[model samples]
Target: MGFKSLAGKFYAGIVQKQIEYQRKNAVSLQQKIFLYIVGEAATTKFGTDHGFSDIQTYEDFKKRVPIRDYEELRPYIDRVISGEENVLWPGTPAYLAKTSGTTSGVKYIPISKQSMPEHITAARNALLNYAYETGNTSALDGKMIFLQGSPELYELNGIPTGRLSGIVAHHVPGYLQSNRMPSYTTNCIDDWEEKVEAIVGETIKEDMRLISGIPPWCQMYFDRLSARAGGKKIKDIFPNFKLFVYGGVNYEPYRARIEESIGFKIDTIETYPASEGFIAYQDSQKDNSLLLMVDAGIFYEFVPAEEIFNENPTRLQLKEVELNRNYALILNTNAGLWGYNIGDTVKFVSKNPYKIVVTGRIKQFISAFGEHVIVEEVEQALMEVARKEGIDIVEFTVAPQITPADGGLPYHEWLIEFGHAPYDLKGFALKVDQALQEKNIYYKDLIKGNILQPLIVKSLKKNSFVDYMRIMGKLGGQNKVPRIANDRKIADQLTRYITN
Candidate 1:
């Protein structure tokens, strides 16, 4: 295929346009970038011919606005739902990506007409760059299977609003049609019950060459497939499959179990997709870090990790950012989001400005017992403990709770899943405790000769976490079971079979 007809050229042109814009406005890049975004926002609402007539300068807009979350835009969302015009960007929102809000149960995130192509292109760039870097263009010619959310679309007052996957399925490049499986007509997102049947009955027949989704869902599908095939391996079921792409959450915990069940070692690609945008994705052969979609209709901002939730946090523009420094991401996108904190923390692995490693969520930490444990620290400790014990882990989550101990309440609890049964659970826990103590001063002070002791390891059944998510109505979608819970609420729910 010619480069002009390929998606890569289209994506490269977009990147070049961004670089040109940056170069032309080099004198006051920040102000010019903000002004351009504001102009886009204003023009969309009024008319294409009219631009930011109300706002003239960056300082004028900055003083008038404060950082706002989705809640602050609830009214606009309501108007969109009501089918009222001029509430949002003067056009009907093409699709609404249902996302789990931090405080709200579920939020319908509107994707504007102008920004849909940007989302599509960013996703394409992720794939193209992966193929270019890994020399795996052959995989693109093979069938691609997305073990994603249901293709079911929900109608709000006769308007479609549901999974974004459904929208993507309908709109992918036509040239790629020959390589797609589950033809567009039959690819609708059905409910979980239907999805399970489809997977076992029909969808698996595509001779799927590439698999994609959260690790838990991927595990669930394989389990069902294996069960139906009378304990047949993944390779036996689909001999053509070559790679597994997953993201939205850490894949390390479930890595061994997936390989064990599939009975083969497959190349893996990780992605970072949020309601705001498709942010980053791993190259096909690259395992170290994900490359950022730098030209994907967004200008990036980063706040130092230490100052993420501070009262007065300062942010760095893209040009001023450095590699290997942990920072909380904030974005200003063509989708009309400005200085929006997407609630993800990441660090660049290379000076290329595009490759990064997703450390963890901004608020996902276990500090209830004054341990101040972050995901990186916990993952590092677990890796070290596993190395020392010669055991592999399929999936694991930690929950800390206070139990009555000698004279007062002390933090006492831990849960883990093993790839192979350990020789001594208690001994392994002690080593992990010691490792954590050396790494975290807070844990050290809290456990210094105290009555608090490491609890027993609650060995979970194989694919137990996937089952838990299925029970919670979060299976086969973007929702993922929490990897680290500070309290016992989730753990207790998952462990209902055990008596206290």
Candidate 2:
């Protein structure tokens, strides 16, 4: 083994032990992080206003700080943007993570110096744990590609501001810099297509081994690479390629197509990362559930998914969460976000070491007829049908069609782009609809009571989603179409690309 591989294996062993220790004492570790964050930020303006100094226990903290979203916390964030010190965290923030918001125009999530390590360390541990489990550290010696946003950042009131991925680009560890592909100059291109072209040109002939990014963008990269190589599968071009590290979306929907592009199935690591914090990562390949980051610099709270919008929701700490129950994830991070609702829901699959599966976004759901169908249910339904029928789905989204032009009962509409169309398209749609009904009781009830009709599947022209995203100026990076929406904002626009 080379020096890099040897060093990686050694580090992986150490981190594996540390992770085991943290999992064993998850509750105590969370308590320590809670106290530490509260103590560290006790003198900040937000802390003073919330009486953080007087907060003695979880109950006290809960009473003092109410749960808040971006809008509710905007006043303090505004003060920070105006160059105020000690407004949110101690002193000034190290950086501001810029992200698109649904209600708010653009959200600026503070990333304090103290909190920055949480992001970096968790990412590092993800790969290290992979090595520990699989006994594969050769990727550390080969080229690695991370398809992400442009690293070019601008200052917001003296604080570096950019997309979370771009901000993270600046902090790539020194050892990995040499192995990382696509030159810094190429990575700074503002236009995503141009940037991908640059990346293809830069890394096409290199020893590319590890590829990481959100699924759709990675699929785009794979397409570009294959076209450049005269339709060669990725594995043929880069024989050493392995280890696909991805987050932001579930990999099941895109897995078949992604594997086809590569010409073979490869190992993958799923992660749950957000602007609020690096929450969890898949620790074992055998177990698909992500191990929650209990020892990370964040304290977590869970509110039953059903009670998320309640005036007084039941908030449970780490030790209190039950298995198989959907909970809205709340965070109290070292970045000075107290009682913060991150808008994601999770279901615990295992409570022994706190492993969870991301259910869906709290806000992104279809409930037009009071049938509250979530992303997980929809994805699961489609995956079941696709797997059974051997269909290749490029991209898809679900929205309620409240008004039908044909004067039929309103029903769910699925806009799908198929790489390989199903032979029995209607049968495929019916199977997916039946699967969805099985997954959601409310949806089943609606179908049974004739309140809603079986879903309609509209085949979208190839590259329709790409075109939509391009038109919206969100072609690449971490941007993804919502899996399900209550309204037709996205579905209506997508109609223009419906295959005749």
Candidate 3:
């Protein structure tokens, strides 16, 4: 093994012991973090306004602080943006992570100095945990590519504001800098297509071992590499490539197409990260569930998914969460977000060490007719059917069709772009519809009662999603196509790309 691999192994051992301790004492660690954040921010404007000094228990905290989304919390965020120190957290924020918001045009989330290191550390520990678990540190000896946004930042009140991925690019450790690929100049390219082309040129001749990105973007890079290599598989282009690290969207939809491009199965790691915090990462090759970061300097609360829109929802702490139930994730972090609803929903697979799976976004679901089918259910149903039928799906989205042109019952419309179309499209649609019915009872009831018809599947031309995203100015860097939307806004525009 090389010197770098040896050092990685030794460091992985230390992180492994720490992981074990946290796993065994997950509740206590979370409790300790909760106390530390409250005490540290007691003097801040938000803390004092929320009666943080008078708070002594979780109940007191819950009663005083109501759950608020970005728009509701904008006043405090505005103060921070206008150059107020210690308004939200103690001292000034290190950076403002700019993200596209739905209701609000643009959101600038604070990344505090105290909370910044945890982002870098959590990511490092994920890789280190992999090395320790599998006893394979060879990936440390070669080039690694992280497909991400531009690292260039422009000042927003002199706080180095930019995309969260861009902000993170600046903090990559010195040891790994030599192994990181796509030269700094290439990464700063504004256009994603141009950047991918530049990246392929830079890493085509290197000893690439690890690649990381959101799945669709990684797929885009793989396609370019194959084209450049005169139709050779990705595995042939980079024989050393072993690990695929990804987040931001469910990988199952793209897994078959990606593996086909790679020409074989490969080891993969899944992570749950957001602008707000690094929530979890896959710690075991044997298990797909992500190990939640209980000790990552953030306090977590969960409201049952069904109750998310209610006037008052029950907020359960880490210790109170049960297995397999979907919950709207809430956060109270060192970044000064109090009772903040980050919009993502997660389901706990293991309560002992607090492992979770991202279920869907709180707002991203098909519930127009009160049959609230989520992203997880739709992804699972479609993937299961596709695997059985020997089909490959490139991309897809579901939206409720409230009114049919022929005056038939309303049904869910699935707009899919296929890599390999099934021999019998009608039969394939039937299987997927049945699978979805089995997964969601509300949808099943509507179908059985004749209130809704079986879902209709419409195929699109190749690269339809790519073209759509490009047209919308969201073709890269943390922008994912919505899997499920209650309305037809996305579905209507998608019709123009439909195959005849």
- Pairs that clash in candidate 1: 150-189, 151-188, 151-189, 152-189, 253-394, 292-354
lDDT of the structure predicted as candidate 2: 0.93
After superposing all C-alphas onto the true structure, candidate 3 shows an RMSD in angstroms of 0.8
Instruction: Report the lDDT of model 1 for residue 83.
Output: 75
Q: Which ten residues in a row have the lowest lDDT in candidate 1?
A: 43-52
Q: Where is model 3 more than 4 Å wrong at Cα?
A: none
Give the TM-score of each candidate. 0.84, 0.99, 0.99
Q: What is the per-residue lDDT of model 1 for residues 76-167, given as tens digits with 9 covering 90 to 100?
A: 66777787654445456777777786566688776777667867776666665655555555455467777666556778755677777766
At residue 362, candidate 1 shows an lDDT of 73
Scored by CA lDDT, what does every candidate get?
A: 0.67, 0.93, 0.93
Q: Taking the tens digit of each residue's C-alpha lDDT, what string does model 2 give over 232-303?
A: 999999999988999999899999999999999999999887877899999988888999999888999999
Give lDDT for model 3.
Answer: 0.93
Worst 10 residues of 2 by lDDT: 268-277
Candidate 3: residue 206 lDDT (0-100) = 93
Report model 2's TM-score to 2 decimal places.
0.99
